[model samples]
Target: MKFLRPALLGLLSLAYPPLVYLGLGHFEPRWMALPLAGMAVVRAVATRERVWLAAAVGALALAASSMLGNHALPLKLYPVLVNTVLLAVFATSLAYPPSVIERLARLREPELPASGVTYTRRVTQVWCGFFVLNGGIALFTAIGASDETWALYNGLISYVLMGVLFAVEWVVRQQVRARHVHG
Candidate 1:
């Protein structure tokens, strides 16, 4: 029960591209922006995380700009904003200490070995690189591609890429663990 709301919100964000594609056919861009802004606000209030708060501000700004200009461009930029925020957060963790991947690894193994720390840092760097490439594609799709293309790439292709990355990382992690155990 405690996790349900956040989970649903996450699903909503995942569904955004297709929703925007469908909504643009029948509704104004300003109308479409409302749900995103509302969700961001709810997430910010619920989590009290700086990332969510920044997202809320960005969403609100998009809504305002869309309303004022009657343009869909702002709505299409949400994915870019999300990727930017994630990249910043992950990159910041790398610069400070205990990279984002290390933090998640800590949840499972509190006393992570030095090798595990190094592996997690590398993984975090990989994720940062992924974000940069993904965000670049997203920006191009948002600015230059048709609505269908944007929806297809952002809604389906991006998730598939992420899943593949996760699967590959898991496989590598298993190999690393096996070597650690035997070596």
Candidate 2:
């Protein structure tokens, strides 16, 4: 299901922080900042590959989270709630704007000539990435967490996957706009 991505992102974030405190690494948890940042960057760059890379990060994050097992259930469930809320918002906003793709036809720019399905997929991918990451973080947060910095590192990084997936939502919207002109 679509929820799977964010759920996994939640899981991936669980491992992030502990890795850093050990002096092993730090970028992992901070990487949680990426989704929103990626959205901003993609908007400026207008590069499909970058967006795709962000998406891939989301997917990997999601996949990585699965390794956490039940750890995700308690630690990072709020993001999942957030993802659902956003989905409801998106569904209400679109109201079938001609076609699913057309809904995404203009993430930031207008479509010269739009295709129904392609744009829809783009839009969907964007959302899929965001929700997965956000929801994942919430799920990670919900799980059992230790107070020490090391545990926090593992716990937070375990769910930082949201950074990438959340990036998906904004990135997709922006991408739809950028590609719209091309169509």
Question: What is the clash count of model 2?
Answer: 53
lDDT for 117 in candidate 2 is 51
Q: In order, what lDDT does every prediction score?
A: 0.92, 0.45
- Give candidate 1 misplaced runs (Cα > 4 Å): none
Give one digit per residue, the lDDT tens place, for model 2 in 46-162. Answer: 335443355444434443453344222222332344355555445544565443434445563364354535556556656655555555544454454433532553345434554
lDDT of 1 by residue, 1-183 (tens): 889878988999999999999999999887888887787777777777777788878988987898888899999998998899899999999999989999999999999999999999999999999999999999999999999999999999999999999999999999999999899
Q: How does model 1 score by TM-score?
A: 0.96
Any idea what lDDT model 1 has? 0.92
State every prediction's TM-score relative to the real structure. 0.96, 0.33
